[model samples]
Target: MGQEINQTQFNEQAFKEYNRRLLNEAELLQTQLTKRCFSDIGEICGYELEFWLIDHNYFPSPINQAFLTRLNNPLVVPELSCFNAELNGVPLPLRGDVLTAISKELSQNWLQCQEAAHGMDSVLMMIGILPTVRQKDLCLSNMSDLKRYRALNEQVVTQRVGRPLRIRIQGRENLDINHPDVMMEAAATSFQIHLQSAQRDAVRYFNASIIAAGPLLAAAGNSPFLFDTDLWDETRVPLFEQSVEIVDEANLENHRVSFGQGYARESLFECFAHNIATHPVLLPMLMDTSPQQFEHLRLHNGTIWRWIRPLIGFDHDGTPHLRIEQRVLPSGPTIVDMMANATLYFGLVRFLAGLDDAPESRLSFDQARNNFYAAAREGLRAQMVWWNDSVTDAKTLFMEEILPMARQGLKDLKIDKADIDHYLGVIEMRVQSGQTGAVWQRAYREKHQADNLQLVAAYLEKQRSGAPVYEWEI
Candidate 1:
């Protein structure tokens, strides 16, 4: 989806051609996988941080256009809404001091972003959903000025047969609304983590990532409130799912943006095959690239927003590589909080992938998917079905089993001990104290009588203090 297209207007012939090429590329990819034709990259990691821009009143401010222009940094780019922006981190090998290195790069880039935002009379905030965001603020007029975003909006609306997108989320509170465009997606932002792997290990790592979603989301739940109403612990999950909701008439069970139908049966190639067969091509922009480039296939794959998306990219020498993108976690309450979340995910996936018997074998795909939604809805209080068919609360499971598993995983990867302890300790204190970002925000609202701006101001103050959410005062 990051790649820009030259043409948005497409005829029937264009769509047919693009679809044919996409299917062919999928077949070529399977052959390549069979022949072991991919880069032998080992455990390379990166991230994309989406954040909001706000005015002094803490309301959504549509100033990212000018802000990004003034900043003139390639690492920063526009998001769906003009008020939102994303900062990308450079890809680095997952090894000693990597966590510290990621934190340093993020902090420095964030500071530069802050300076840029200030110049435009707006401040950059890192949150899953801005508390001050209102239904009226998500209009198409506020969408970023980009051809790809415009094309996406047109295509999604077209798919719904020109009907308004309807979103209904039932949590502690109920939210029911309709929008004419996909801008509702702009209300949510996330901290998407990416891990590159060798083709031989890609399938195992991808499966492990799916299984880890439940505990990972439970330990890191941040978006609890939207539109001044308390919703799911991670409301972004449902909000995003509904924002671009599409129903295939041929197959009603599959959606464009989904948790996925099931785990990978044999190899990651099955995922690509599923995408090509099940999903209709939304974007049919003709590209003048070779079959090996797989540009059409990659673009079509980008349109289908899976939770754990498989990616094909090339190294500096143009050697193709496979990557597993983890998309469940929400963006900030703090820098340490973000890094801690990354550490837990990387460590757990590495550990789970090495098991002689795959975790997915013990845990059914339906069970894994159900556990994800439960954790998103209930946070740490959620009970999850683990391996061996045992059900336990998320907090206990993390403290007793998951944390130790992560520690060993990091140790096995030869990560520095201090880096391991510092990052994992943040997760330990957060879960043990039962004070995740969601908890802290909910507590603040109760203490302040639900003043939205005051809640945001307090959050910003605590964020500036550079303390993790667990240590912050209400």
Candidate 2:
């Protein structure tokens, strides 16, 4: 969950005052960056994953308030709609057997969430999109009873000049629909991985994450169906981009949610400054907290959903630190699979960021951005341009080059040898077998001529067995 606001409504005066504070904080952050005042601590791993609550009929269940009350865990919290919730992991130092630790903790939390939901005759699911969900289920009536969510709906519609949200996607099949509120966003969920980097390496880490996003998503495409139509292998990507559209009369590239304009050159503060100048603040909730906490600036940043987002966090000593959030992956096929994705991400970023000649220097920002879209559209078979500027399918690149680089990267991190082999091996098998979550779903549907409900049922059964996607059968 993001920072909660005391009130859902604001006046023009409040907006102006909030803007004043936001700009001041950005300037202060830039000053800190210039002075190298940020904390030197680095290499911390964290995550926030979004999940769905489903009834026995395999459809979205609107019972999160009751479910959360029974679960009573701070790590688990309500999401945009009553049918969804989010799970956050404790921050941990990234070394030794940390990947295994993540798998264990996430599995335990997932099991507990299921037990809580089961008490009310509901089951919890982790996926990019619940296929059985209907347009009627994503209405305002099902929106979470939270002031922040409602405020977002009001602000987005206001910014769009009351034009309905347009969602037009073309894939193996085509889908065109209009939604009246921001609730369409609730249909897509994701697994966000965080990296707390040393202040010296922040810019490099952010840029490296941008370069790795395309291939990472190619191995993790999980959402392929929405509203009974076949769309992109990772339909959530485009769905999310369209769901939160705000009218830009200036026609700027900032769309509230995007891949971003370009990689950072000098400091991550460039992102905050850009936010202050170009992106209109969505939730201008005023805070009485000390300016040192960056409350106003963070509140504004939370509303703009970048695929690779730079984060500001404070240590226990009140020392601010920089972090990079990798937001391109989907929620789940299984706990181990998510960890495998995490392993690949950490390794690739470590290797790419440490390169004497930065990978970003070799791969242009346009290629990185275009590669991401292509992978989202075509999954593992998508052709990608490597650092050598040679074109190859994502599967071929993963098999021939990316996996070796990831292994060497993890080794360089001093991560335990067994953990490296286990997790990366999972990724290797997943790529070679051509069995990402999206591919599995499409295969099941095409082979058995199964309805969406049957496909979801089979998926849930396999997911319950706690096997990775490569091992899951249609």
Candidate 3:
């Protein structure tokens, strides 16, 4: 979705031609993978953090055009809504002091973004969903002024046969609403992490990410309230899945934005094959690139929003590489918290990938998918089924099993002990204290009778203090 398209208008002939080329590229990619023609890159880490733009009164502010123009930084880009923007980080090798280095870069970039937002009389906020954002604030008018976004809205609505998108979420409170455009997706923001891996290890890492989603999300759950209705601890899960809901005509049960049908059996290329076979082309723009570039394949993959997406990229020398993008974590209670989440994820994934037997072999894909939604709905309190078919609460699983594995994984990666201790320690305290961003927000709302704006104000205040979420007072 980050890539831009030249033409938005599409006729039947154009769509057919584009789809043909897309499949051709997919075939070429498959052949290349079979021949092991991709770059053998080591572990590389990066992230894209999404944030909301709000006014002084803590209301959704649709001023990103001016705000971005004033900011004028290449790393910053517009999101689905004008009230949202994303910051991308430089990919770095995951070793030694990499965590600290990335944290410094993110903090500095955030400070610069803050300065630019202030220049436009708006403030930047890092949250999964802004508590003050109302239904009125999510209209099409608030969508960012981008042709790709406009085209996406048109394509999704057309796929739905012009029916209004229906969203029904049941939690402590129920929310059922109808939306006209994809703007409902703009309501949620996230901190997405990426890890580049060799083709041989990509599938294992991707599956490991799926299994890790439950405990990781429980430890980092944010976005607990949407439109003043108390919902899932990580409401963004269902919110995003349903916001642009599309069902496959061939398979009515299959959804475009989903937790995938099953695990990758052989290689990550199986995912691309599944994508080519199952999903219809959402963006059919033809690019003037060779089959080796896989432009069409990349664009088609972008439209399918997998929680753990498989990505193909190129190195500095134009050698193609594969990456696993972890899309589960929410944006921020603090930058350190975001880093902590990334640390725990990288460590756990590395540990899981290095196991003698694949974790997915022991745990069914159904169980992994169910555990994810359970954690999203229940946070740390969620009970998850792990290896050996044992069920346990997320907190106990993290403390007794996952955390130690993460520590060993970091040590195996040769990360500095201080860096590992500092970041993983944040996760340790968060689990022990049972205080994540979602917990703090719920606590604040309970005390203040769910005053959304005041809650946002308090959140921003604590956010600016540069304290990890566990240290913040509710």
Please give, for residues 20-47, the per-residue lDDT of candidate 3 as tens digits.
9988988888888889999888799999
The RMSD (Cα, Å) of candidate 1 is 1.3
Question: Which tens-of-lDDT digit does each residue in 277-336 have in candidate 1?
Answer: 778888898889999998988898888888888899888799889999899999898999
Model 3 TM: 0.98
lDDT of each: 0.90, 0.92, 0.91
> In model 3, what are the clashing residue pairs, if there are any?
none
Q: Give the TM-score (vs. native) of candidate 2.
A: 0.99
Candidate 1 residue 341 C-alpha distance from true site, Å: 0.2
TM-score result, candidate 1: 0.98
Error of 2 at 231 (Å): 0.5
- Clash counts per candidate, in order, are 0, 0, 0
Error of 2 at 403 (Å): 0.6
Model 3: residues with Cα > 4 Å off, grouped in runs: 248-253
The TM-scores of all predictions, comma-separated, are 0.98, 0.99, 0.98
Decreasing lDDT order of the candidates: 2, 3, 1
Residue 34 miss distance in model 1 (angstroms): 0.7
